[model samples]
Target chain A: MAFSTTIRQAYQDELAGLRTAGLFKEERYILGPQGADIEVEFPAGADGRPVINFCANNYLGLSSHPDVVAAARRGLETHGYGLSSVRFICGTQDIHRKLEKRLTEFLETEDTLLFPSCMDANAGCFEAILGEEDVMIADRLVHASIVDGMRLCKAMRDTYKHSDMGHLRDKLIEHQDKRIRMIITDGVFSMDGDLAKLDEIVALAEEYNAMVFLDDSHASGFIGKTGRGTHEHCGVMGKIDVITTTMGKGLGGASGGCVSGRRELVEMCRQRARPYLFSNTVAPMIVAGTLKVLDLVFASTERRDRLEANTSYWRRGLTEMGLDLKQGESPIVPVMLYNAKLAQDMARDLFAEGIYVVGFFFPVVPQGAARIRTQLSAAHTQAHLDKGLAAFRKVAGKYGILGKGKREIMEMYGK
Target chain B: MPIDKQMILDYVIREYLEEDDDTEITYNTELISGGIVDSFSMVSLKRFLEKKYNIQIPDADATPEAFDTVNSIAALVERFVKA
Candidate 1:
């Protein structure tokens, strides 16, 4: 037994197989700030122009805002770079309290608790709230973090098929006798860019005697009337039982997440959740920057309006180009490419024309449901969007995906 | 005895598989380890069994070893009936 086999190497071999299967995705480095236009490192090409970036989560374009940058500089000067301690210890700075209080006010919740990442927010929420005697009913297409969190919980859990109200009702009725039943879902599905049926979900929760938890990471900073997220989008503000969202995407594009709910629940999570209790406090720079983003969201709707306009323009142009578009009101616009190879090829070809997008296939999405997820930012100008649409149309034609493009797709479908 | 086995099979299939026609499930086979039934479904199944058969399934007994397949689940049910 001195030299026994270790299956650890087998896992890496499997990943190699995935790479050869045309599913291996690697990140490209960005040498500049996140904005509508971004510079991606690639070989020198014709124009040497930066690609029209459509993949960043910088929805508000606050990542490089002068105010946000100034706030970060001030935070560094006042509080330094890192805390080197967790919240309950010496990590609790006065600015952390100020950020939490401000977030509570912004989200209209009694209290808010921050986590290192929204993934942590989701992973820690389940175990902190429910136990073995309780039950959790979640949407099938909720974020991966929620699935992982539910796995950590000892509570009985079941997933209703994505957005199927009938299936959810049946499962809720089946477990109607459980002590605590929580219905959890994402406010907007990140992949399809479609919105959840929140109004319907809320009504169902009331009938099932279940509390609702919404992860609004994708919807928070630029959705709804005041950009208050799905609560505002659905006109159900103050109706949701729990709201969990991130500061990483639309909020400011730095890094942090929070669970906004009743005073007691947030307090309970503060005392128990592993990440909140153990992880280092979020840097004061991120706190101050996110607080500024929130101020912008509240002070004016110009940015949100611009984002909506840009989304509509891109969606309409792509649709007119005879591309398959995922139906939704969200800014995430998925261009369907049922074949994984085709999706990856399209993304590569689009890059040749100075447009950056991400191709998603199986494991991330279901088989025969591959897509190119294009995100629009408020930072983009109409001219930028028009240029992107032109590039997309050119790539689609090259891939044989439009008019005569339909013929090539048919040939592949027959194969 | 045959009626009890059929009942267990029906319950497992109905509880785990949502769309019966589209989804093809093989009964009396290793369900959990094969990834056909996940841990979440297993917990719900345990709750169903406790209510249906009046069997108190302890945390220790709720493992794939005890109830991996329909046959094993039926055996557990029979053992609970006798106990």
Candidate 2:
């Protein structure tokens, strides 16, 4: 008749342990919409601090764009706010199909099936296509969503080193004893911001007669020359067997995801994936706003170009400051602070200097690999970049990590 | 010249695995099974060995069993390096 004290005490003890280890995470409250500049109220009930944001996934800065908002309003007016059923029921609207078709064209895949988020797409895609005799080989550093998706499958799981083709090739060979082999990777690894070696991966897939599955959540609307994603960026457009991407980041910065790839695979997901079969459809307004985002990105690479240029500028600025960074070619730049407390302390100090960045520690990254991950956006102005750099410089100076690299930081903090 | 086993041992204990001044990691110390080295760190350790020796250990040979000890890792590296 009452809640169990045993469970409550167990959780409380675990939480207290986390806080003692400095691994406990505290979330900041945002008083305004998503953007390069936001009002954050931390420690609860504190005054909102106006700061330049460097941690959001709002890569194209379209999260709060006026056009996208108006399109969402229109969608709400036309289709109402909610879909009370799943895709196969009364939920499939004309707008949903339109966005799916648009995504297939945008991603250069044969067909598409929508999901509520990339996590669901990741969870749903594997079980739909693979069987017990198959093997799903993924990168060691692939997203957790993919890992969970693989766990749901009857197929066996093996992992290659991050971006290690030789290792992947070994797995392919070893799993040659199986009926099918699927190579799973993130087109852009969100943490390190490195593009997967897709060209090489595709070449291996062709040679080994394996299918490739990519989760391009971080690179969908702003990666390639035409913003077609990693396939386009890597010259392997039609080669990927299953491509999953999100409309939540670069698309509309709202919420929706899709599995776009071989027509049969997409169709299979639509028919068999449990999430697609059971979950409520993505909201009509999100689909509508995403469609508008598609049009804007497809028309010209203006926003994409801005994001790329900003990434380059930000990367250069951070490098010039002599900060140790994980070298990559994506908009996510992590300022490596090997010590966990040092990272949290730096982030807190940076916030004090009117910059918003979060410290990523163990459980998110590896135990020794703590960092402050900064993201660049098309929404950011040169002024925002300059101020962010200034804040970073001030904080780095305070922590005495300004010019120190990984080895030095680790030595100081005993990683 | 043959690959330096001592360097490999020291690097693994110091870089990949956290070691204090008195932490003793002998050639026979269990690395993976003893929970000192995880799969992710094992990959980085593999990369370090590959880079230092200028030889690639095919992923099949780079298993947890082969990397469970400093001696085992050195012996694995010697095969490729000597070849």
Candidate 3:
């Protein structure tokens, strides 16, 4: 069969349109491990340079920690590399079970089951439990993976306004006739750094007899006092029906995720969740590294404290410098620069100033709410924070993006 | 009760296009194609229509052409309301 010229032309046209619209995504090459300070290579064979990283989800800074690395090395030596099987097959090692147990204790849940990644964990959960008679109501700003997961499930889907408890209550009342009503939301919305009103959600769940589900991928390692996640922060521990989170973010920055909740629900996922039943097991190295992260997180509050301090200090410095920031207590802070072009331009200027951050615009956020979402890390010291703040002030000043001048900048962008 | 185009437009403006000027949206105004109503907004709009008019918008009618403009949305709602 001949190649379809029509298909090729269609793809070419789409790619050309993306390029013209400046919506084409380009990946920057990082030459070193993920950390607060790292060398990165821009496109076009640009030379590598060290910059303060503000885009990583390494909230606890355990990504490249010496002890975590050592644990991974030991994990490789003892448990080998790949499992080459799913959990139910020959892949249920003692470490995997141990890690799941540790996660249950850390999350303060009934049980936990691991997946290859949080994406898979989210994908697997909804379909495993929800049936056609059920209803899955979600926050509009929940992660894309959750949206896709709900799509795959047979439940009738409804979404309320983001972070609006009144809208959620309305949705719950509207869907009260369903056999089971499941309310889904992100613990911390990644883009805006806003948290779900879990306290109110739990209350509404009780009023409507609905189950509350939280995907705490962004909140897992540092939101609460001991880093137990949104449940702890919201003071609703043992109330949420299900909590899904990742090791990819705060928990050592490796690749794995889990669903921790009721024992029956977890057991059902273990047996029926497609991603869990079919995909390869979590690598022993990542599991070991994550186990170490749990140990460190449980042993001491130093990292969590440093992370909280850094977040508050950075937030205050940025606000005092007159940068427009979204309100939240999460380490994920979004400096709003409404114009998409300005967001891209400011991110580029900040990169030139040796501060690495990405611009989010258009489809990632709403059309008018473009921003540079900077995530704080425990690894970012006081000096790193100061340097980053200085760079931000300088670049923001160059673009005239200060407090009173923000309106002028928006008008200049014709937004 | 008959379907109300102005009511539909007002709800869309209030919920999805809160930042947009009220005069900007009219009966024939483009919604999805004009970038005002995204996929999430479409879901919300469908639910709103279902609740208000007691009409179930099948997935087949959830296309951009079928619901892109306020006029098209009003027409779709009218069809189910009359049926």
Candidate 4:
């Protein structure tokens, strides 16, 4: 079959336009396992070097932990590799059920169902339960997966301004005529690290007779005192109707996700969610590694405590250096550089200085809101943070982006 | 209610660009193409216009040419209100 020349030309034109607009994305090659410090292979035959990584979602630094690796090895020995079938037919295993139970206990939910990725979990959840008569009012800044999921459903969709309760209340009132209403939001806004006001959302949901859904992917392993999730952080442990999150982030930095909720909702997802029904079962290695991760998280507060300490210390260090940073309690810190070109240049300079962080601009965020999002992990030591701060001061100073009298301020604060 | 261009511009500035002081947006400012307003914000803007003007904006007419600038948005509202 001959392909159409016009269609090919159209796609090529789109690619060229993207390049011209500076919106084309490129991937960096990692030479080793994911961790606080990683070896990266830069383009142009540059010698690979170890850089302090600040962009990974390995919040607790358990991605390459020894115990987790051993558990995954054990999983491979016992359960082999891929299952090659979906959960219902011949793919369900004892470990899958055990992991589900552990997740339920940890999240304080009635039931849990696993998916290949949180993207899939979000994709499958909405369409399965919501109908044309229903309405889904989401926060404007919810993750792309949730947006795509909402698009797939027949629900009358509306979005309130990000974390604006008044706007949310207005939206709820606007959609009051719908048969069923569900309020959806992310537990933590990834870019800004600001948390969803779940207590306020819950109160609004109660007043409007709406159900609440939270995707806690960014907060699952290290948000609250016990690290149970944002529900625990916001004092709404059992008030949320559904919670979906990922193993790819704070949980284990692997590939899997789940939706935990009431027994009836979970049962409905198992029966009707297309991704859960059609996709192959999650790999046994990931399941086993995640099980061990849960064990570590529950056994002690050591990692979470260290993570909190690291975040505070790093945040303080940057503030003292007079870098413009978004104020938040989450470990995801965004250093604001409003100009897109400046953000990209800063990221490149930081990379050259042995710091690995990505710049988010334009399409990722709104215009005039470009920034470099730096995440903290428990594995980052005080020395690592100090070095990273020094790099920031040097590069930002070169670009004349540092605040006035920052050097004197740093001296006053004194390392 | 009668549609007003200044009123639409005031609403956009207050709602979306209140914290932004570096750039001043006028009636002819390119919103969609310039990335000042994104798709999600467009939905909110549509709803706001619908409610305030007491008119319906079909999804098909909610394009950049119709709603990218304050002037265009006001024109769209006027068209719907007249209809």
Q: List TM-scores for all candidates, in order.
A: 0.86, 0.86, 0.96, 0.92
Candidate 3 lDDT tens digits, A14-111: 99999999899888899989999999999759999889999999999999999999999999999999889988989989999999999999999999
Each model's lDDT comes to 0.82, 0.88, 0.90, 0.88
Query: How far does residue A168 in candidate 4 sit from its true spot (Å)?
Result: 1.7
DockQ of each: 0.23, 0.07, 0.46, 0.53
Order of all candidates by lDDT, from best down to worst? 3, 4, 2, 1
Least well predicted 10-residue stretch by lDDT in candidate 3 chain A: A404-413
**Fnat per predicted structure, each in turn:** 0.20, 0.00, 0.27, 0.53
Docking class of 2: incorrect
**Which parts of model 1 are misplaced by more than 4 Å?**
A1-12, A42-49, A403-415, B1-83
- The residue-by-residue lDDT of candidate 4 on B1-83, one tens digit each, is 66678888887776665353445789999987877666656777887898887788998999877888998888888888988
In angstroms, give how far residue B77 of model 4 lies from its true place: 4.7
Q: Predict model 2's lDDT versus the native.
A: 0.88
Top-down DockQ ranking: 4, 3, 1, 2
Give the CA lDDT, 0 to 100, for residue A347 in model 1: 88
Report the first chain's TM-score for all candidates: 0.94, 0.98, 0.98, 0.95
Report the number of the highest-lDDT candidate. 3
Alpha carbon RMSD to native, model 1: 4.4
Ranking by TM-score: 3, 4, 2, 1
| Winner on TM-score (1 vs 4) | 4
**lDDT for residue A49 in candidate 2, whole number 0-100:** 93
Error of 1 at A78 (Å): 1.4
